[model samples]
Target: MKKSLETQTQLVSLNETLINELSSLKQVIDESNKKMADKMDITANALITSNGSLAESLTKAIANELNSQNRKMFGQMQKIENLTVESMSKLSSRVASDQTLSKVAGNQQVLAKRMDGLATQNQEILKQMEIS
Candidate 1:
C-alpha cells in the first residue's frame, strides 16, 4: 500500500509539470500572435497611405492634362473663327463685284439694241437713194 501511495504521488507531480509546460506554451503562442497582428496592421496602414498618395498624384496629372488640352482647343477654336471671318469678308467682296458685273451686262444689252436700230435706218436710206 505504501508503494501504491508513492506511485500515485509521482503521477500527480508529473501531471502538474505537464500542466505548467502547457501553460507556458500557450503564453508564448499568444505573444507571437499579438506581434504578428501588430505587424499586419502596420503594413495595412502603410499600403493605404501609399494608395492615397498615388491616387492624389494621378488625379493631379489628369487635371493638368485636361487643362493643357483645353488651352490647345481654345487656341484652335480662335484660329478657326479668324479663318471664318476672313472667308466671309472675301465672299462679301465677290458678291459686290458680281453685282457690278450684272449692272454692266445690262448696260451692254441696251447699247446693242441702239446700234441695231441705227443700222436698220441707214440701210433704208441707202435703198431709197438707189431707187432714185
Candidate 2:
C-alpha cells in the first residue's frame, strides 16, 4: 500500500513538470511570433521607402531627359532657320546678279549688230576703191 502511494506521488510530480514545460513552450512561441511580426513590419516599411525613392528618381530622370531633348530640338530648329535664311539671302543675290548679267548681254548683242552693219558698209566702199 505504501508503494502504491509513492507511485501516485510520482505521477502527480511528472504531470506538474509537464504542465510547466508546456507553459514555457507557449511563452517561447508567443515571443517568437512577436519578433516575427516586428521583422515583417520593418521589412514592409523599408520596401515602401525604397519604392518611393525609386519612383521619385525615375520621375526626375524622365523630366531631365525631356528637358534635354527640348533644348536640343530648339537648337536644331535655330540652326535650320539660320541655314534657311542664309540660303535665301544667297539665292536673292544670285538672282540679282543674273538679272544684271542679262541686261549687259542684251546691250552687247545690240552693239554687235551695229558693228556688223558698219563692216558691211565699209566692205562695199572698199569694193568701189573709194578707200584702200
Top lDDT model: 2
lDDT (10s digit) by residue, model 2, range 1-132 = 999999999999999999999999999999999999999999999999999999999999999999999999999999999999999999999999999999999999999999999899889988878655
Cα TM-score per model? 0.69, 0.72
List the pairs of residues colliding in candidate 2.
Answer: none
* lDDT value, candidate 1, whole model: 0.96
lDDT of 1 by residue, 23-90 (tens): 99999999999999999999999999999999999999999999999999999999999999999999
Q: Clash number for model 2?
A: 0
Assess candidate 1 and give its TM-score to the true structure: 0.69
